[model samples]
Target: MRRIMLLLILYSSKASFSYWSRQMNGIRVSGWLVSCSYSHFTTSCH
Candidate 1:
């Protein structure tokens, strides 16, 4: 019983970690894109 419970906990934690990492990656990509565009605009204006 304890072994099964441990396995379940491990599985759930791993699943949540993957999901969180994916979300963070998406946010980072969008942030990079926004910064790139902003720099391009500023350089073009000057």
Candidate 2:
């Protein structure tokens, strides 16, 4: 019974960690893309 509880706690923590990491990675990628495009636009206009 104690082992099962431990497993459940570990699984939940791992799942939440992965979910948050994925969200952060997505935000980073989108921010990078936006910055790249903005820079390209500015360079082209000059």
Off by over 4 Å in 1: 1-11, 44-46
Write the residue-wise lDDT of candidate 1 on 1-46 in tens digits: 9999999999999999989999999999999888888988777522
Write one digit per residue (lDDT tens) for candidate 2, span 1-46: 9999999999999989989899999999999888888988777522
Any runs in candidate 2 off by more than 4 Å, and if so which?
A: 1-11, 44-46
**9, model 1: CA deviation in Å?**
6.2
lDDT for predicted candidate 1 compared with the true structure: 0.89
lDDT of 2 at 16: 99
Q: Give each prediction's root-mean-square deviation over alpha carbons.
A: 3.9, 4.3
| Candidate 2 clashing pairs, residues 3+ apart or interchain | none
TM-score of each: 0.61, 0.59
